[model samples]
Target: MRGGEAATLEAVLQSVEDPEIPVVSVVELGIVRGLDAGQVTITPTYTGCPATAVIEANIREALDQAGFEDIQIKTVLSPAWSTDDITDAGRQKLKAYGIAPPPKGAKAASLCNKSVAECPHCGSINTREISRFGSTPCKALWQCNSCHEPFDRFKCH
Candidate 1:
């Protein structure tokens, strides 16, 4: 790879949207952790994420289409993935997509804790978790008492 090739690859990867959340690119979701010469590193939101294979496949397709077939993808589970890995812009995009972004800095120990989740639609803090699991495994179903609207809350971990 020549100078700036890796950066170009990173930018290309930025165009690959998450399979579940199309509004946010995988890059914005913090899945593309590193971009080095001839390689891109990624960490799925969860280990058993059903979309993991899809995400990788999408990335592979994108790379091929972008003339980056020479680039390889590396999946890493160490250091783990966290809601905190989500970029600030990603959080904003999630809210705009009608899903409550998780509170930052949350860990597994606080999984049962009911932190106030602002309703994405009406921006109301008055919300309740209807179910620990939402439309997907990585989110929780929540309803806003004020807006009477149901939305998904991206689970933190």
Candidate 2:
């Protein structure tokens, strides 16, 4: 492909948003692991994620629009995905969008009693979880005591 064409694909990838979390782009979320030869390989943030199909569709649409007709989309599961891989900009975007981003390695250690569920609304640790399932499959439902508002917490992977 020509130089401009490759740039077009990059631009298109930046536009593909995570279907489940509307605020973060799949690229910034570190899901698009690599791009080469009209092919884009991605690993889902979470396995069996409900938004996998939509995310793939978005990637395909973006590539096609960028003139990549022979696009190949692959999903890699080994090595898994972690919240730590998410870009700092993506995390900031999530916060500004009113959704709390997963803390660094907090979700993994959360199972050991080191809960990192801080209230996004109040920035206070005084919060309670209402449900594991939030508006999206990737987030948990939580309520803040300080703000008295319910919000979604991005689960650590």
Candidate 3:
């Protein structure tokens, strides 16, 4: 595979959206670690994330559509995934999709301090944590004071 082929493969992978978060593609979310002519390696944003199966299926379909019938999908657990790996564009897309992005600079240990995850609807910093687990185990539920709207907070890993 050469220039066009490599680019096409990349594009196909980029088109594979995260099943859980449809707005952000695996590529944009920084989940796809690497893509080769015959293989794709990805690290889950959350350990034991249920979306792993869907992501794998998407990768297989994407590469197969790109003419790569033989695929090797590897899930790497080392270096563990984190919300910090998500790109700025991916964060924006997440917000656009109505899901609040993770708090910037909000380390896993600093859950008490208000990070950068402003309410997507009201842009308010005064938010209350409702639950540690949201719709998915990867996110937390939060309620904004300004809008009184409840939203999911992408957990800051």
Question: Taking the candidates one at a time, how many backbone clashes does each contain?
Answer: 0, 0, 0
User: Could you tell me the lDDT of residue 54 within candidate 2?
Assistant: 86
lDDT scores for all predictions? Answer: 0.88, 0.79, 0.81
RMSD of 2: 2.3
Clashes of 2: 0
Which ranges in model 1 have alpha carbons more than 4 Å from their true place?
108-113
Q: What 10-residue stretch in candidate 3 is worst by lDDT?
A: 108-117
Residue 119, model 3: Cα distance from true site in angstroms? 0.7
CA RMSD per model (angstroms): 1.5, 2.3, 2.1
- Please provide, for model 1 over 37-108, each residue's C-alpha lDDT reduced to its tens digit, 9 standing for 90 to 100: 668899988878899999999999999998988888999998888888899999999999999888887865
| Alpha-carbon TM-score of each model against the true structure | 0.94, 0.86, 0.89
5-75: candidate 3 lDDT, tens digit per residue: 77887888889999988888998888888876567889987767889888988889878877788778888
Residue pairs clashing, model 1 = none
Highest lDDT among the candidates is held by which one? 1
In order of TM-score, best first, we have 1, 3, 2
Error of 2 at 25 (Å): 0.8
